[model samples]
Target: MSSQRYELVFSEGPGTGEDTVVVAPTGLAGPGGHPVYEDATGIVRAEISDRGEVRVLATGGGQNAVRVVRVRPLP
Candidate 1:
């Protein structure tokens, strides 16, 4: 459990969108041992690879093409 925090910016288009805060070394891990994080509402889950690739695992209900476009470190 790392103390580092990160901001995951989600978008459905070409602009900024919803943001979620995730702590490093989350409880889950994806393929290749990447870190996985979920939104507070549990409506979105994403796996971020070491190369910064974001893979959306689940979108609770909506079938929109939601994706994580940016990841920023938080203090």
Candidate 2:
């Protein structure tokens, strides 16, 4: 596995919609053409690519307090 610094970003909905942006430091090509954030339990979340794009695959936790947890990449 490779590691590098990354930026996990979240943007809440305005009066219309909600979106998110994830910036990877090293521009690593992850699963499904875009980057992927996988947790310890092998749970993977959608990730943005080097380009600014957003894609939602899982049913997010809802419009409450959306959690945007950032983990320090192992060296």
Candidate 1 global CA lDDT score: 0.65
Question: Tens digits of per-residue lDDT for model 2 on 1-75?
Answer: 234433344445445444433333324344567665533333334454445343433535553554443333344
lDDT of all predictions, in order shown? Answer: 0.65, 0.42
In model 1, what lDDT does residue 60 have?
A: 57
Clashing pairs in 1: none
Report how far residue 43 has shifted in candidate 1, in Å: 1.7
Candidate 2 Cα errors over 4 Å, as ranges: 1-3, 15-32, 39-44, 59-75
Cα lDDT of model 1 by residue, 1-75, tens digit: 222456677766665567555635458888757778666666666677766677777555566666667877667
Q: Estimate each model's TM-score.
A: 0.61, 0.31
Candidate 1: lDDT of 38? 68
